[model samples]
Target: MTGTIYSLIPPLIMIILVLLTRKVTLSLGVGIIIGALFIHEFNVMDSIQQIWSAFYGIFVAEGGPNMGTFYLLFFLIFLGMLTAFMSASGGTRAFGEWAITKIQTKKGAQLLPFFLGIIIFIDDYFNSLAIGQVARPLTDRHKISRAKLAYLIDSTSAPVAVLSPISSWGAFIIGTIGAIIAEHNLSNFQPLESFVRMIPMNIYAIIAIFLVFLVVIFKLNLGAMRKHEQRAEETGELVDPNRNDIPGELKEEFVQTNSGRIYHLTIPIVVLIISTIAAMVITGRNNVEENATLLTIFENTNVNLSLFIGGLIAVYHSAIFYLIQMQPKTSTFLVLREGIKSMLPAIYILILAWVIGTIIENLGTGDYLALVVERSQLSPSYLPVIVFIVCGIMAFATGTSWGTFGIMLPIVGQIAVNSDVNMLLASLAAVLAGSVFGDHCSPISDTSILSSTGAGSNHIDHVLTQIPYAVIAAIITIIGYVVLGITGMVWITLILSLVLLFATALILNKLTQS
Candidate 1:
């Protein structure tokens, strides 16, 4: 079979395996086995050689296979632990206690998770774990389901990252997009500014974020979510409010604790947000965090370090000083250890994901795809939509957004220069939309796994549940891109797509209910 055939086989097999078993690691491992088989001429000796060669290619790319997720996994794990620490230390409970105090109505309660998600865009990893940990109690207080909160947090994670320039996510995204300009040799191409402007035009991201807000504000109905809103309206407890009486630091503090104390929950989170911005400035990332030339304290700091620092500070200030009970105990240290330990499985998966990406690169999969794209000489007008779908497919297959970008950026540059493509915007749109799309729905995606695990939903449950919503949004985005190219009305495409998405989500919600 051809390289293209081989390239796609892995992801398809992986997807089928996931749909069957709902196990991400198992699916990915199976995907790897298929990939090795295809490349190795279906011989055992050849398969081993192909896998080894594939692994070798990862190191040559200046981004080793593990390079993509090493830092991210580290940040996510510790970030989880920090959230656990805060929860265990009474910090999260303290915040929840306070948030529930102001809520005389169910409406305010639903809106709180939305608010928390919006604020946490400072860092997606921070946003994911932090919001999940902090808001769980508040949502629980308001009769919110874990699924609802997970949806809010997951929805917020990417949209905020999509919009915010100063985030851990921006670096990879901005980097890939900028490469298009360099590859196309576009004269006077302003990489950073171009990327910023394209965000509004990136329809899937803009719409998904908007849909979440609508869900909260207008109460646009969604699956199993209506039950939650009704319950909260009646009683300020979860749908199944009876505590299982599980003993430990996690108790019903939201109803018991005062509202003034609830605002304390917002403090470390607020500081983390402020500090994140401050860190960008402090570190010299400038306001446009990804491609900035600014220099300072964080100039040399990797994103994971920044996450750790921000998390430490958020826990110390928000939980330690403000939410303290009795006295600071040694258990806080234990929680950190436990949190780090919790991340070990994810860490291993990250390494394997990278390794597979490396193997794929060894087969020259990305380069081959780039070559195919370049030689096809696709029209500039369709580039944005094409890029979005193509990159989405690649990411869906590989389960690594960075790997998808790594392969696509240079190739996109080649196309932009060779053709009329707005290399910067088109490339930017492709990488951002593709990465987010992949992470949003891919079974093997690390973020997807964590979101499900953290929210207590089965991994496949999350994937199966979310795919319809994600696909609908993607369809709207395609229309948005086409309209953008024809009319040159960027904002029109942006706002209209958001509207369409909300309507579609509403429809999906109604469908899911039926």
Candidate 2:
């Protein structure tokens, strides 16, 4: 009993710290110390020992963070580099400039991003950063706030990844849940089918994205976040205080490639999509016993070879440009280095996040948190909402969504099996939805901070501004999940959540006007 009370102290303190100060790095570091102090119950010297032990556990626990972590982290960063290489080669800018010429209206401004989100269905991490970078200058030209642009990029990121069966996220989610079910000896039904069904029912992502479209289309009235949004509308000369004292003409003429051409930019992304799908189909064969590891899919699929060949093709095309005297050696080097350097922030966060996850797992936060849920009357019928809310709070407190999901997924699986519910569907949705919800609200979250940085807004400002919209989506999504519990869920929750939220948004607009 005392142990549990001590365990609860750390996470609770984290919440108060974030609410008061909104500093993500400090919040996360403080939370770790709190967990170390209370949960581990270590003597002062032993606490230091345990903290080092947890960090070691992540980096060297055989197949722990060392093996699995590298695959996703490298995959994402390299994917970013490939996209960067293409932009440097003049692929992305061609598209951006061409769109500026062709799409002259505001409606076109909105649709362009939605289409990009739909088309870039390979990976969420890739989707968020790539689309956000590509669409920024164009949307800024038309007065779209960085927050709105970030929302567009973010909404499309995981939501599209969840729906698309071929992406790496699809592979990880399916593989994780599938393995857990099989471990518990309950692998009777087709898990992929559940994944497919859940796609239509991923209410929060669908609804949030839908609200973005509506907000842009109707030029809706901003409520709580109007100040942040209005900041984007100002045309006054506020110099970027952080810019190095480079000449304006030099910066303008610096040949930003990702925004320049379509072929280089589009080809690599399209190849990535094709390769990811091919990997999924090859590994996910039979759906019931698709025991595909990351290595297996990477080695088996010709499409990855194709992606590599496509990357080679990009290099080869650049070679041709050098022959034509359009390529500069100095410029190409800068782009590659820039691309690698650009992903460092994300990479550092990934490493720290994994370490934190290891700490929580070792300290038995999951078991303690699980005990709370079990005693708290959290029924299966209301599991989605309850789990969603809980996971969100945990993620927000801890500042690590992946870590939150990793802990929650197993507990959710245990509950699902115990309740005789569709464990795969219910548990997976809860983790994904919960992670995103917490990430959306968490000031310390990598994505949350990145979105704010991308928008050039203050991180706390972004969190405060984004919360009302995110909460609206979360609330309506809980209702949609509840509706499923009642009606046996004829349609997908994504569709229902979108419809319900849109109606609520319209009503909000009406109420504000009245």
Candidate 3:
């Protein structure tokens, strides 16, 4: 079953189940078990062992704990606590009160996260959760839907991070591109230059960013998102009332200070941003060789550790503020407990997602998809779009863009080298673009889940509402890739793609309104 069409069954079943039942945890659990069974040829003992090993691997690998996963999970927990403390301290209410005077419009509330998402492009994980904490109050005050807020965060985080040279995503991609160049013996290819060049060719990311602003500025809510928006506008219900397990939602009642100020919220976030960046730089510096440049430092930075440090500091800071402001009877222990409790649902979903992702990888789902792409002897002109679609499918199924990049980049490199050297960058850009598009649509994707957690939206609601917008951008990206493949003109293709995207968005907005 490994590295064959049989490997596709588990993910396909999982996806179908999620869409039909909207039960993420159950669906993911079933997928994990089924994948394990398939990998072990239905041998009960071996399957059980495989499942255990995969589950164990999330926290333990080799001889030590998996710090990356641990750090991220802790970050989420701390972020939740931070949010709870901020709210309990009246920071959120104060921020909302302040925003009402400053923003004064629903459009401005929607735009806050959009712009913040772009401005904070160091890492998608940080951007997704942090933006939610900062902007949720404003969006809620203005009656903006949580689904829309999730879309804004999801749309901006990856697109901006993927494009920025200093970001974690960019550093990884550049390093990967360098290895591919060395392996293929493409001496003329400069990794940094190639990455910069591919930025414009990443039609999906660029167009996704544009689509977010267009949707916000033009009020282009479509499909399920329209329903979410309508509900928020009419009833002031930011989230779907039916969903009881929304993560990052502080349901526990706590006392708020009459003297709540915007600075209470802003200070902790600022501390987080500054401290995280400082940790990244410090960690990067420690790991780098003596003549390391800023880019190399970022490439070697401990992003998870940095995030953990930042979240820890922010939580501590918020707690101090909360303690000073809260009523005498409000126990600190309960606030912390409630904050942890609020994040448990997200944590479970994440762990399940990791386990299922591991099972699918063990089943060689990505390998099967990569094999299909490798076997296709398509024209060079079709390679960009073909790779785009394949990479998208792989990421969507696996629910991990970085995983898809690891599996597909090498294959894309080899395929582009053998087929047409001219299309290498275009094909490479397609991998990044398509992976993000697929991640945007995948219900199991970490960014999507985090985006939902961040915006306090129902996870399934975020996925359902965001898919239509992602698909539209992807369709436009396909056309853009086709033009890039045929013309080999980055500037022309990018310009035309943006034009088409704006025109499509405008037409759709007008039509949807009618």
Candidate 4:
């Protein structure tokens, strides 16, 4: 009943179950039930009612955070429609044929996803799915592993979003920091300034992104990734043998429609990108000062609404394109149906992840952990590293970086103030970086799950292949925080960390090859 050791049980149960059974949905569902039971004094009926209420509350509640969930769900559906239409129109096939001429090498194929991921930094969810859908055909043609493609998708989504000043991720962080400042009456604090200053100190994101380039450039395949890549290269088996379906198999019904023109693919995607950016700017204009920069507009934008509008426009554009080409209206509609259906599994997982995140919040897990840190006798200089490790662990266990941020930001803010931690920016960056690092590793993470779905790889396979790379980044990030904590020199810490990461990548390459 108390926020003590009992608070840890739900996440521990979820993590243990996921690892053992490899059933992310069941694990999260059971974890939520356990948390409900704890909150309801072990009364099974009461716990069941509480669980139902929580699920219901996500939709009907006024001013609920679940609006973001709704936005993401619609985004997925429309994205599915877009992909379906592209495949049925022969856009993906035509694009693949075109791409192979320019990107003939395996390294170029791998790098394409990396580049696409970086360019689509508006939202992580959109980034993961769009990059996966667009780049899969190219990667497959060159015999690249789906696992590596998923890693590229997952790594770029969160890392790039968090680092970009004009992104949904940045807006969320700013809002969180703003709330902390207002609640605590921190008169001297400036959320935007602090957020901008902390960007470079987000070492995990930087390193994770850097590692993607290294892996693609140097062909550094370690652990299960190496096996997958070797299998793909030697046998042209892009999909893992253990998986029941091939990557991008869901689009097979539409592949026969190949129009033999790259424009079939490029047009819809261009429409999607341009419309989304325009929506963001127009929607956010009212909230900004005169002559506001793009970053300011993004910070003020209703990202959920912008994404919804953009998605609908993209769907309409694709549908119209097909109709103009003399395709039957029914055929276009069929693509819509098939696309939405393909995304249903991912949508289900996303809902469950949200519910589990709600349960963790109710259980006071983050508060209890923060209290433990408050009571600790650790030195002030170690706060950044400690916070980084704890945030990483919390995010890994909970599978929601936003949830982790909501829980940890206030606690870290207080710690920075009370402990006189001169490295507040470094500490803030640690929380952001660590949350992303843990999310990258967690099987139940929405981004991780979606990355797998996007790349048509097994969910667990993506997690297994990505862990070594994430860990490498996490280790280096921890070292960066430690150096900043000790020296309070941001530039020096950054230089040393970059060198360390590059060196570590070289070592990994040598060791993996050996």
Candidate 5:
């Protein structure tokens, strides 16, 4: 069952339908039904029952284990509420006005999100949602397309999170590495040290982050993204024309009072950032020694609960600010309602994504993919490249980088330790890099979905426009891994890869213009 090719059918069907119909929800539904049928041996009634059971289990029956899903839903709702409060109180408008005075160019508008994404490297989910919410108003004012904004938010998120030493992603990777070390009985293994060593070797993340700057600095937009930028610039329509029911667009004009100050927006956001970090430190205190390091604190922190507390604090702060400004309590309630309402579509998409990811996991998608890689007969020198490609495909199909890491890391670790293939570190780096790269490109990925939700961008447009850029980075990353595998020269390979990426971007920009 592990290596069965049949396991690929569901994701393939979903991807095809998404590309053809441009309907993510419908595509996921169909994929789920099809997966159910496969799991039940194609018995229609049994498949229907299984699908229903899965829905119930994910949404209701499995409560404690599924707290993460609930946390995300609450986070999104409160985020929407925060956005609405900011907008209705004129905080968003005031901030946009202030930003326009300082930044007065499209590049600045795009670069702001890039820098914010890098700064909020604690978690990709937090990074995507917060950056998108903050930058949407500025990007729209400057006529930068939502798709481009989503690309920036998404590109910065997992890349920065994966690279940061004291972040949720770093902790997760370290844990997985530690498990692999224990399982394989590998001697002298230092998880944190190994992860730090792998940072320079994470070619995809390095290139992805660099590409954001290159695209922003040079205004490089190709394919669907170019058309989107053109439409936004020429017509002042920052939203996708095909889908005009953008979440926050309708509420953009409804300011409760003209007395909104920039502090109204800045204060809550600052509180959110501070509260989240503090909560993380406090929660992890019991788990660590008195002289705990920052990394140790992050490793022991409960990210979901900390994020929930942060969101709650931000919401309360926003509400109090409105009251202090003499805004009616009724008006504040209405704004919160509107904010919650706007997130309904995103919430529905997220639920489906979770269900599908669950289905993929139950179907043993990652194990199947790993089995295929295990069976492949390749040279030892090519192991890193192969592992990278396999892990990327698994993450893209399953729409979860963390899940991919959990399933593939142990397998890859064992393979690397084999007598013939001594590539433990290289393979580990490849798995890490590939997981992030694939999640970056996956339409159904939670981070990707959150990016679109946060940017207030059309989900499919974000996926379509961002894929080409992700593919470009993946190509260069593959070359870098190949060079590393063969020459064992990490620094040299990285330099060459960086040069190649810049050249590729320059050439592609010229071709797009021509």
Candidate 6:
């Protein structure tokens, strides 16, 4: 059943169930079970065993505990505790109070994450989580919906990282491009040079980033996002109160004091940002060969471990600050417990997302999609647009942008080399753009999950609310890719895509308001 039509059923079922029921866990569980059954030829016993193996494999790989998974999970736990500490110690309150005075409007509050997301272009995971922590207080103070905050964080993080040459995503992409170039004997192109060329060609990323600014500046609240924003504005409910499992949400039992200084919030975050970047460089240097370029160092960097180290430092700083600002009758360990509790919902969703992703990989859903593209036998001029759509579908179904990139980039490279070498960079850029777009919209994407967790938004709410905006950007990107494919003009395609996105946003805003 591998790489066949049967492999598509599980993800399709999962996506449809998510749309209908809005139960992420249930949908992922069903998808996992169905995928397992297919893999085992519907033998119940074998299917059950396979499912167990899949779950176990998350924590145990290669005859040992998977330290990478452990690091990332623990990082989330630490981040949750950090959020709790800031709230319990009144850091969040102080920050919110101060922000209200400084940032007088919702638009200004919303733009905090927009700018921060672009500035923190180290890694998408780090950018999403860190920006959420820093901007949530201000956004909440201005009554900004969590869904909108998540959109701002998500839409910028990947786009900025994908375009920056010094980022973690950039390093990995450059390395992959190097391999592809080496294989294809493209001696005229340097990996870094080729990546720079693809920057303008990555239409989805540019258009998506541009749309974030338009949404913030123009208040283009579309689809479910408008409901969330309207509810927040009219009723002061930033999230869906019916959804109790939102991560990073402060519980009522936590103690908050009035004695907190602005530094209580600012210092720990500064420490986190500085420590994480330092750790990334240090860890990256240790793993790279002598005299390796900066990109190579980042390519070899231990991102999960660096994030864990930074989280540990931030938590330690927060704990110290919490003790100093501790009100009477409050226990430090109790605060820690509540903090861990706040993040457990997100952790569970992340684990399930990983499980379903694994099952889908085993079922060969992505491979089937890639194979379909390979066999399409399309004309050269249509390759970029076709690749963009198929890559989007694979990333959407699999909920892993990097996995989609790994699968599609090489295949797209081969297809381009054999058919239209002139269209290679444009085709490759489409893969990057489409992967990010699909990942942005996927319910089960780790980036999406983390963005929701960071903003204290319900995971499904984030997915549902973000889809319309992402789809609009994707549509504009498709048009750009078609133009690029036909004419191979990067500047014209980019300018046209931006114009279309801006016009769409303005039209949507007027229609929604009217």
Looking at model 4, the pairs that clash are 90-258
lDDT per residue for candidate 4 within 200-276, as digits (tens), equals 88888988999999998888998889899899999998776656533234645543453436777788888877888
TM-score against truth, every candidate: 0.76, 0.75, 0.98, 0.92, 0.96, 0.99
Tens-digit lDDT track for model 1 on 307-346?
A: 5556566656744642355543545555566556655555
**Which has the better TM-score: candidate 2, or candidate 6?**
6
Comparing 4 with 6 on lDDT, the higher-scoring candidate is 6
Over 4 Å off, model 4? 63-67, 178-189, 245-251, 287-293, 326-330
Model 3: residues with Cα > 4 Å off, grouped in runs: 326-329
Candidate 5 lDDT over residue span 343-397, tens digit each: 8878888888888887787788888889888888777778889999999999999
Itemize residue pairs with steric clashes in candidate 1: 54-359, 98-262, 99-262, 283-298
Model 5 clash pairs are none
lDDT string, candidate 6, 157-181, tens digits = 8889999989989999999999999
Q: How would you encode candidate 2's per-residue C-alpha lDDT over 85-133 as one tens digit per residue?
A: 5555565557667767877765677677777877877655546644654
- Each model's Cα RMSD: 5.8, 5.6, 1.1, 2.6, 2.0, 1.0
Sorted on TM-score, highest at the top, how do the candidates line up?
A: 6, 3, 5, 4, 1, 2
Q: Rank the candidate models, highest lDDT first.
A: 3, 6, 5, 4, 1, 2
Top candidate by lDDT: 3
Q: What are the clash counts of all predictions, listed in order?
A: 4, 14, 0, 1, 0, 0
